[model samples]
Target: MQINVNLNGTEQSHDVEPRLLLVHYIRDVAGETGTHWGCDTSNCGACVVWLDDVPVKSCTVLAVMADKHRVTTIEGLAVGGVLDPVQQGFMECHGLQCGFCTPGMMMTARWLLDHNPNPSELEIREALSGQLCRCTGYHNIVKSVQWAAAHPATVGAST
Candidate 1:
């Protein structure tokens, strides 16, 4: 099957198997490696990417399902050269330890902030509950989202 996806603001078209996973398409065909492929069962949020502005586990979604849709990977989180507030928040708060779950966490955090600019700590925790980070105790991750909430900016990045 042939699939066309607006990936990170760039249009990408490729021929792949009907059952090819979106994660493989993004990495293998689209040549974007920022979106990690982990826990094929979708237990790990490592493969999370935004499809038409809504975050979805890429491993659980077929590439064909993303046809004609917008997909935003971690590579697209920055605008021009300015990092999204979520990215900045992660760095400023030391949110990441091993850096495996950073992308999904950041993506989910960005969505949360875009929807609720001033999410409380509990709200932040709840929003990121799906993503699992084995390295950190999630303290700094929550702080990172909170930092993003407090430091909202006009990051020309697309969701």
Candidate 2:
């Protein structure tokens, strides 16, 4: 299958297997390894990416299904060498420990802030329920999202 997609603001086309998972296409073909591949069963949000501006588990999506759509990975979160607020928040709040789930956590957090700039701690927890992080116990992760919320200017500019 030949799929064309707007990846991280760049138009890219690739020939891939119909059954190829979007995560593989992004990592292998697109050369964007920032979207981590974890738990192929989709239980882990490590493969989360923005498909047409909405967060979806790349592991669960077929590469062909992403044809003609826009996909944004962690690499796209920053612009002009400046980090997005969510990324900065993660750093400032020490959101990640093992770093395995950081990419997905940030992706989901970015989406949550895009839709709801002022999410409560409970709301932030609920939004990230699908993503599991064995490290940090989610305390700093919640604070990370809250940090991004408080700095709307940075996040809004990145988007």
Candidate 3:
């Protein structure tokens, strides 16, 4: 199938198998490797991406299902070569240890923040419950979200 996708503010078209996962299409065809595949199942939330501003597990979504939709990965969060608020939060708070689940976590957090700019700590924890990190870095990850909420300027306040 030929899929037309708007990714990271750019339009792209690619011919791929209907069964190809959106994660694979983003990584292989779109050349966006920032989105990782930690677990094939949607439960992991490691392959999360924003489809038209809503977070979805890319590994479980078919590439054809994303046709004509805007897909935003971790790479898309940056603006003017600057890290997004979530990205800056992760970096400043040391939210990542192994960095494997950072992208997915960031995408999900971004979505949450978009809806609720001032999420409480409990809300942050609830938002991140779906994503698992073996390194047990949840402490800093939650702190990062809190920091992002407090310092929205660094994240550009556009989100």
Candidate 4:
């Protein structure tokens, strides 16, 4: 199948099987490794990506279904080699550990902040309910989201 997808703000066309999952396309075909694959069953939310500006678990989405859609991975958050504020917040607040789920978590956080720029601590927790972080215990992750909320101009800039 021939499919086209806007990935990381760039257009790409590739031949892929209909059964190929969006995460595989993003990683293997599009060469974006930041989107991780934790649980193939889509329970972990580690393979989350923005499909046309909404977060969806790529593991459950077919690449062919994403044809002509805009997909944003963690790699897309940065602009001109500058880290997005959410990424910076994670770094400054020490939100990640083991680095397995950081990409999806930050991706989710970016979506939340974009829609709700001032999410409360509990709201942040609720927004991140789908993603699992066994490493940092979500303490620093919440702090990072709070930091990004405070510095929305830096993190929530339109792409």
TM-scores, all candidates, are: 0.96, 0.96, 0.96, 0.96
Instruction: Give each model's whole-structure lDDT.
Output: 0.89, 0.89, 0.89, 0.89
Model 3 weakest 10-residue run by lDDT: 150-159
Model 4, span 74-107: residue lDDT tens:
8888887788889989998988888899989989
* Model 4: CA > 4 A from native: none
Scored against the true structure, residue 68 in model 3 reaches a CA lDDT of 98
Which portions of model 2 miss their true places by more than 4 Å?
Answer: 156-158
- Tell me how many clashing residue pairs each candidate has: 0, 0, 1, 0
- lDDT of predicted model 1: 0.89
lDDT of 3 by residue, 5-116 (tens): 9998899999999999999999999999999987898888889998888889999999999999999998888888888888888989999999999999999898888889
Against the correct fold, how does model 4 do in TM-score? 0.96
Assess candidate 2 and give its lDDT.
0.89
**Cα distance off (Å), candidate 3, residue 90:** 1.0
Whole-model lDDT, candidate 3? 0.89
Error of 2 at 38 (Å): 0.6
